[model samples]
Target: MGDSASRSRVSYPVFQDVNHMVIFGFGFFLTFLKRYGFSSTGFNLLIIVLGVQCSVLIEDLLIFLLQREDENSLKRITNAVVSMTAVVISTGALLGKTNPVQLILMTVVEIIVFHMSRWINETFLQVPDNLSMTHVHLFGAYFGLAVSSRFSEPLPRSEKNASTPKSDLLSMLGTLFLWVFWPSFNSVLAVDKSKAIYNTYFALAVSAVTAFLLSVLTTKDGKFRMTHIQSAVLAGGVTVGYAGHGIKYPWIAMILGLLASVISILGSYCLQRCLNPALKIHDSSGVHFTFGLPGVLGALAQVVLTVINNWTNSARQGHLVTVHIGAFCLTVSVALITGFITGLILNLKLFKTIPVSKYFEDQLYWEFPHLAVGF
Candidate 1:
């Protein structure tokens, strides 16, 4: 009963779109590493497979513990897919610096924490973020950064960390897939599904344009970086995540998208250089800019919209704003503490961590052809 029946009816097709984003979109998106293609795509597949199964089990266990009725099959699958997404985003930040065993272990720990945080946001705080503003994107990004910070050795500059022309092309393919499917992703649980879709589409289109323009302008040579194109172009979707379901105007989505693109592209151009040395965080795929900051922007946008909608009632406005901010703070705190602990566990000698010398090379895990011509 309730919203579950209706959610189930429309869930599958959108689920397929989101699943595509997880599989092909994310899989290839991380393939920008020239020598780490196999690890990038292969590790992503392994994590998603493990994450989905674990997430479903954890969600079901939690529901039973809470004495709540079970979600329908479709809804459960949808939630599992979404749960895996946070792990995938976190993986992006830790890519090339982690071994397969370490990644598998991290996936399990992160999924457990993610589901618990999600439950708290939904049950205790009644967070209204349909697109997982704080619970997924923000938490995933910061958690990965936190884990990366635990490494004693910084990610060294090496040829293997650089992308080849072919790898960049593959990464762009992933970006296009995400750009095309993101509207379906944002609208899956929206109250006004059509409006969510429309707003998300508008936001993405604008963000893409802004990313391209800035990439050229920001560089001394006035050339576009494949990194910016691959990552920054998608910030619009993250920025509009919480707002997509309720925003009443196309202009609002466009403005949010524009701001998100600027922040993401600028972070990559400026912040990425100093962030590692300054904070001891080595972000492999710039997740902090692409997901973290845009997520914060989206969360704030949602709070502003909540205020606007309840302007006539000061008491109601204050309560809703408090809930929104409280949820964000809780999600950040839980993710950082849990992620830091997980990092400490992974740092122990027993985990068989990746060596600094083998950071971004697929040869450590994958076999290659004698020539391996294009790769």
Candidate 2:
């Protein structure tokens, strides 16, 4: 009756925004694949389920053990959404590579590692980041990429992960869902009348457009690639997450969006044409461009904005610089090492797993009941 009566609940609309983003946004986003629609959406559903269940338990238990308190229902739900989002980002890099059961197991190990990293940085590293670009986005991308590199099998060049008219249309539904609600997604945590939210909303719109235009312009023959457009348009949200609270100007948001969109398109090109093969990593959803590098850009933006805002605070500046560096090193090292170990454990073959050749297609897992096959 003491603190319970006085505690404020998260706004209903904010919770709803994050909810839709996770469900419709992430699910449909993966459906862009031409052949792997079944596996793509199905696997996403699986991981979300698995990740949610395990995330609650792991997070709550850690809270009890470490903080010596029990979490309330609302907090658990909110944190569960955040945890699932991180898992979903990680899954993008390993899409079509693992079966339902394998992905479930991976979720278990991943939640453990994910929470551990978040806790260490928050509790010990004292990093000025909560859902910071480095913590949530980059951490998942690098972790998934590491796992993909170690154990993921590549889709053959002859294989089709390309988009069909219907598939592409469906994919856009996912994009639209994500794009429409993105402002809410970014601004939900901010105070009312927050510059962060304002900047975030505008930045999202600008990036989406810039990403679309740049995607068309940057292709080898100047033709638009769906992958680039899909991945890069979201970079705006990532960039503005840096200092949305302090960034009072829309032009700055535009500039950041423009730059992030360019980098995202370029990241897609290089990752697809060059890095994937040379690095021996099979990134199924091209998450590096979409979520990974943009997040890094966000981290950079954080530094730039901090400097521009408070250039005269020498001692505070020194402390922030040190914390940022430490945070980066900690996030990268833990993500890579922990992800590699998780992949190894996933490779143990205790479970009956699907062959790598059957990676992307839907028949291996989901049942499609309605299509009439011809002789």
Candidate 3:
């Protein structure tokens, strides 16, 4: 009994670490572009704080509305952080494209959508998942991407290509913060404490190694790019979370990491080459590669390979395989529809508008050192 209690004690530190990842990881990682430092940190701060607060309320109300007995303040806050991470992921898709108020509105809509989807999954579907890929990664990425596509047309690059030595270094700091704490982020939800934690760490190491090697392998000059380092290295966790848990052998996780890393690296490259020029789809942090593709594909791949009866035996699963598929489809549809509507609302004339020329520059949104309003 004491051992069980001790294992549960890990929750507090897990909360602290995930908080660091958000406060530091998400903010500074997006600071790679030299010009957008203020928007990256300042607006990110605004949007994420709003996400956390709204998550607190939505999650609490959800508990009461559903009449859950085991739910408590600590669990609600933990879930709020998890949901807030999803919000942060969505914001990555719209980074530098929209203003602060737009994001606040989007966050409110997203949290409500997220909880609704979650409630359906919990109440009707009850499928157990070992990773955040579904809850946090896939929904946020796709939701943000859908919203971004709506706001996008044939617009010239809303952002600039300004990466300095210092910006790169700071980006690495954010990467380091994310990489170190990700195990805790994933492990916080683990039911089998020891094995799940081991799987998380193993997957992180393999994915980092794979992402680094693949990143180097694909680059023309054999020089490491911060984009790959800052993002794809974390695919190890995503890959593991996707479906590698409880496999009879351990090396399979390494292979999954390798595949996920390769896809992530190429996905980023393709978005830069094909999407930006053709459609002005500017994913500021290339989150599609790190979070979107990996999460969706991982979930699909796991579903394909996993035995339905097997999953039924896992905790909380009470439905047929078709129900799980329906839940995924429902979540995706709701996210896209909500995101599109949110984009339309942002485009309405009620909000403060940012000039095209000053899209990525911090001066438009913030008062800082020698802030210059674009003519």
Best by TM-score: 1
Ten contiguous residues minimizing lDDT sum, candidate 3: 152-161
Highest lDDT model number: 1
Question: How many pairs collide in each candidate, listed in order?
Answer: 0, 1, 0
- The alpha-carbon deviation from the true structure for residue 209 of candidate 2, after best TM-score superposition, in angstroms, is 2.0
lDDT of 2: 0.74
Question: Model 1 off-target regions past 4 Å?
Answer: 1-9, 128-134, 153-155, 371-375
Q: Model 3: what TM-score?
A: 0.87
Lowest-sum lDDT 10-residue window in model 1: 127-136
Better of 1 and 2 by TM-score: 1
The local distance difference test score of model 3 is 0.71
lDDT of 3 by residue, 1-375 (tens): 675556457567777887888878888877887777777877777877787788788766765877766454555567677777778888877776678778788888888788777777766666553332345777888788777776643245433646788888888898888878876776666665455456667767777887778767888899777678778788767656645445445566566666677778888888788876686566767778988777766666566545543665755343344555666677777777887787777778897645555556666667675544662
**How high a TM-score does candidate 2 get?**
0.90
Give candidates' CA RMSD values in order.
2.7, 2.7, 3.8
